[model samples]
Target chain A: MTVDLRRAPAEKAVAWRRSPAGPPRASQKRQTVIRQRQYWGRLFVLPAVVLVSLLIIVPSIQGLYYSFTNWNGRSATWVGLDNYINGIFLSPDFARIALNSVCVVLSVPFGVALSVIVANLLANNLWGRAWFRGIYFLPIALSWVVIGITFAYLLSGRGPINGLLSSVGLGMFSQDWLGGETSALISIILVFNWSYFGINVVLLFTGMTTADASITEAARLDGAHGVKMFFNIVIPQVRRYVELCLILTMAAAITSIFALIYTMTSGGPGVSTTTLEYALYTRSFSLGHFSQGAAFGILLFLISLVFAVVRLRAGVKADDD
Target chain B: MTDRNSTIETDTSNDVPLSATPPRVAPPRSSSAAHRTGGRRVGDRISALFSTGLTRIVLVGLAAGTIAPLVFMVFKSLTKQDGTNAVTFDAWAAVLNGKLPQAGLISLQVSVIAILVILSIATLAAFGFAKLSFTGSQPIMATIIVLMLVPGQTFIITEYFNFSHLGLIGNIPAVGVLYGVTQIPFATFILTNFFRAIPDELVEAAIIDGASYPRVFWSIFLPLARPAMVTVGVLAFIGVWNDLLIALLFLPTPGSRTLSVVMAGAQDTRTFDVSQVMAGSLLSAIPCIIVYVIFQRQIAVGLTAGTGK
Candidate 1:
């Protein structure tokens, strides 16, 4: 009891020191503590710095150099702007893949909107809530490789999905989902949303379920209820989560859909579903054009780097506040 | 706590927790409040435009929509292609001798090594960022944030080139090291927030008693940060386990094939057997699905940690 009593004053002093930050206000011992924090902090953070630099920093510089070369995974000569020029205008394949990546961005609003609506549904007062959550989030746990196969099986011409449609007299609506040019990109986007929507649903529902109770109650008492209360009141609170979901989903779409596309379509139907990430893979590893692939990778890196900068700036500023 | 861990948490550890930890303790409490919404489909049998049964039916349908593909894949893999969908292990039997299981073993080996590599690197880096205060710390962290923003695609080409140059291609441990390297920034970011949540008094008191920083860290913080470590470790596990492209490029040989690469091969023009495809997909997916089942709640917390709450 006495130990607690004696420690209380020191704790208070520490708290006091924290509330009003200034070197002028700190005692000699407190100053030492701050110095200690700084020394140890630097020691801990540097390995990650060195490691990340090796992994990404050095490689990115090498990638930039490779972009300016005529290298095909072998010896090379300088080929300034040739790759970029081809990537932007001359190469029809590159342009198609670039457009397909935009299709990923266009697919985002559907995902976010559907996730929000379903999250609201799951947040309702109901039995079997946990079961529903488990079911919805199940796909999020599966790898893209697995989701790709599952979709491929279902969308095949003689698959069970078409069988079910035919049994129900709806066979005309079920085409060879992954076999056509026009429908192939749409199918990719749809499956992409299917594979991931559960994650965002759980994410948004977690945010919505955790909104301030008193505020929600206040809104309820003020005759704002149902969809109106959800839109007008609850959404503002969970908007940060919504934004986080957007940034993450957009990033994943840009660089990480290679598995799904590679497995399901192989950028098929004459490159209908080819996104930039897939193009990068085929150009480098498949076609043995490492330099061109490096250029494509650089282009995507710059795009995602922009998002990363915005997020980091916001993160740093938020920390300051 | 164990129930929550079943949810698999590391997927969202990328967000640097600008706001810190204590705020996170309260989120689950509101999940209970979600159970108490006013007359909004209360009594489990009350509703408006449609009866509650209809709502439940719709919900069950939606749930089926999400998980049916996985269930279908599993059953199809275990069933015979004898035209009657009779449950048999023909696909499973064939796949066991095929490349799928071999690639699975490779993935298992790689994921284990990658998890260890990531944990060792991320643990100390996170501790430093969370506990050690130094000049330029903020700027250094900001740089990490920006580096993280650069997608893996940005570096994969050159990384492949460098690895090929070094002849590290098809080497499982090298890919493991790469996995660890890619994950450091995010894991460190999560661990730093978690480490910062430890009260300063304990460390200060230990320091005053003539204890070294490493001693205090190992003795005090490591034990306290166990859950966070598990969370970060499992998150890293998911990342390494789920990857396909880099592993495919780096380990192109048939013998070095990882589970995802083998699954990708299922769709190749040379082989179009649906059962083999499903079987390979299951082999690749089951580990992550099992992890998710075991760590469901922890996964949600880790995932949400960087949402700026």
Candidate 2:
């Protein structure tokens, strides 16, 4: 970490003066280098700071400002807290959409827990470990659009599931999974799990990879097997990974799009599947209520921020202890 | 398919028993059976066999759930519903001849532009954050972390008007820029760690050798940062390629749609072309898959290195 700036001539002169080396006036050189380092530091950071400010920092502030105003995608006027009051309290979409988001959030822990269990098994070198790992992690690479299209194809009224059921004389069991108010959100949840479980598996696998295997071995030597070993030995070791995964899952699921809903049900069967993002889109772009959408965005942001802050604090405390 | 198989083969061969020098896994029990004559190793073998069999069945079920949608998409994309019971390639043909190319081009444009902007800004920001001391740096980093938690939907309404004011309304480039910026926090956070991992002595030596900080960065830091840069680039590209909401919002102009946007658009025009959308989705995924396959080890290492801690 030393910064030294001695001109070539000075080095040559010092060399020429009999004694080839005696630190070469370290004090004077250190001063020059420190001053030069300050200049370099400023130069290195200027462009990055400017771009970040322009693109992310300023826009974020603008988002905060716009939450209070009734701007209709054009000119803006101050409306105090009217937008927030109307969007959050008066409008019923906020409650409905918030509930939908909660539904999505509630499903994440189950999905993450399942993924971790499966990952622990795979990490243990059980049957078909490599193939199972690949299969478990494949859906993460697929887009939500693809997930929606595929699920809709399977669950649509005249789709293959019904076709199979009718042919098998189980026609009574067939239902329009993606077409009913009761079924739309459930179908989306299933598709969401299938699409995201791969990522969870990968995260869990990564977590398990770092686990101290000697601990597990000791547990196994003590006659622990399967579920017992997982709960008592492996789980504690991956607590941070599990927590981080939960936070990420909650963040992603909460802001999930109407894409699947847009394609499969279009937030229909009585707007039952309209999550916050979907509702925000519907309000702003579809319904021309800009400030309301901004308000919804703010609420979503605040909720996500709360969870992130909680996770961050937990992470810091974990580090401290 | 052959390429994918080869990559899988490579991963398997390279990853066999990493703890090779000293046997990591315990050897199965054998000699203990002599103490219990009749109740023996035979029972353990039988139980192990039974467990492995049951595990295989469970594994198959897991695979079926994971693979079913993809298989369904492939099947639907290949077959067209012609009248009563007939199947045809009309959908696939339409996808290839028209929608595929259009969607592919749009996605490529968006992904490339998005990656370029994101890499440039993110790499610089990473350097700044990793190397330079500054006032309010910790707060700014906290803000970046907060922004990462805030979903992109939160910024959409504000950005929609902002882009409009910037005269970028209906432009795919504007949408690309937005997607790129949304990903910066992740890229910068990741790359900053990568930057910090570089030996400070290397950079100091370069500085002592009369190189400027910029020169040291370009020569020393950038070269050392290749894996991290690639990781960030790949993730950013994937994010942009898969983005539907941003495109739907800002790039509403006809023919300006990315693959995901166009795939959604296809739902309106015709009966859903499962094969076409699958083909498009698979095709959109190819560039990343290729990069991932070629650099699988680097990717695995880099991602694990960046995110694990």
Candidate 3:
């Protein structure tokens, strides 16, 4: 379907004549073209390779080395395994941070389940489906800082949530949502779910759209409607999407909630809501424990590596299918 | 051609006749049974109506929950901070005239530069990976994937050391370059997938017409890949614009802080004005919301690219 505007008749005639008599010359030209293509290909990718090496790959290797040493930003002394043993095995603060991280990671299932229900509801030809999708996804556009600041106000002692609760005579249920230890972590988890719900819904809704429409219609006719059909048929069809949602949510919870924790509670009620990533920030930047921070970073990387392997395996399986 | 023809043959083979299988035999019987069980039908209909009504109510509630914080934010931004119910623009004025404009300008500069860097490098690398076969491509891509998988925090401390060694701390363009490089893996993944979907015939025809590889990429693939490029650029823009960690760590100076870093700092001080802070948060969110609204479709396509068929 491509327009061959540059292939003039004279050039074609010459190529035809040359090809019949000089096959070796034509092959040589092809080899030259291939070599040139290879050259250009390497050149094309050169900048990206250079930048990534300088910024990510080299720094990561350095970080791995630093984790085994007492590198306080400027100076380093070889103290192998000291940082890791103390940071992971001995410190009480590390236990709290690790537990908080686990709590965040455990919240992924609830977020995914809620997204699935909402996505299925919206997948039906409901009224104003597009508007609803937009509304749900609007939070993804806001930075975590914005969401965190807004929620910080909303969860404050005299905020609108409590105000409304008191107005409705449910005043006993009201408290400072982010002021206590357990409640602070719980509030952070809830906010994380709320902010990430939009993207998950969009992803799952896209998956639902890809389901075989005729099969669902047939199922509906056969009295397989509502919750039964959704669990048995729709979810099975979109299992890849559900897995994807889980992987993404886990990754976000593990590595990307620093801004959220920083803004909302500042990891407060005394490190109650401090995730590993936030702990790394405070340890290295706040407390000037660079090597300990690097150790935490390594631990976080190992955890993410598990999810990454799972995701890659799913990708390969999907490709084969 | 052989592949296409074989697929067509398989498609035809899959189209078995409906008459060869028993079909619609249960539907007619079910319809008759429904007629005999009129009360049961009414009960089913009532339950269905009730379920749909309940679904509608839940949907409305969810939508309200989603939009409530934003509404509250706007309300807080407008209301006077002196315990009065009257609406005032003082918060907006404070945000507009204060450090917000400076921070906003820095954010724009960083995001724009980062987007340009990401688009240029990512498109080239994607084209190479998608169309040009060369030695070590697989290993390089594998390394990139590994880098992508490892969280950015894994390298933050070392990056700080390296940047400080190079005296790039507080440098805006350097920070932009870091953001661009960090996003290259995802951007290249998106664009490579998009470029692979393009028919190879176009490249073959262009090469036969004596076009060089770069010319073919420049004149053919580049124009065709505009939508993918836009998606990558928008995503990169939002990412760099919304980042807090890099901005906070790299640019620690008061004058060099981004909007997010400024807001983070504002939230820390004890004696801050609540309305002004709300206005600042709203101001920072508007540009990203506008971008998301306009490119909503492309964004959805970009986000769901690898997970779907």
In terms of lDDT, which candidate is strongest? 3
Residue A52's C-alpha lDDT in candidate 3?
A: 94
Q: Write the per-residue lDDT of candidate 1 for residues A40-87, one digit (tens) a residue.
A: 666666677887888878998888998999886667889999988975
- True-structure Cα RMSD, model 3: 6.4
**How far does residue B294 in candidate 3 sit from its true spot (Å)?**
0.5
**lDDT per model vs. reference:** 0.77, 0.70, 0.84
Show the lowest summed lDDT stretch of 10 residues, model 1 chain A: A1-10
Model 3 CA lDDT for position B265:
89
State the lDDT of candidate 3 residue by residue for A151-188, as single tens digits: 99888898888999999999998999999999999999
Using TM-score as the measure, name the better of candidate 1 and candidate 3.
Answer: 3
Whose lDDT is higher: candidate 1's or candidate 3's?
Answer: 3
Best by TM-score: 3
Residue A290 lDDT in candidate 2: 83
Best by DockQ: 3
Q: Which pairs of residues have clashing backbones in candidate 2?
A: B77-B274, B77-B275
Model 2 scores a TM of 0.86
Chain A TM-score, cand. 3: 0.90
Each model's DockQ?
Answer: 0.35, 0.27, 0.45
Better of 1 and 2 by DockQ: 1
Which digits, one per residue and each the tens of the lDDT, describe model 2 over residues B225-296?
A: 887888888767656776788888788777787777877777666565555666666565566556644544
Model 2 per-residue lDDT tens digits across residues A149-252 = 66676887888889899999999979988777768888878777777776677777777876666656644543456665576567766766788678767777
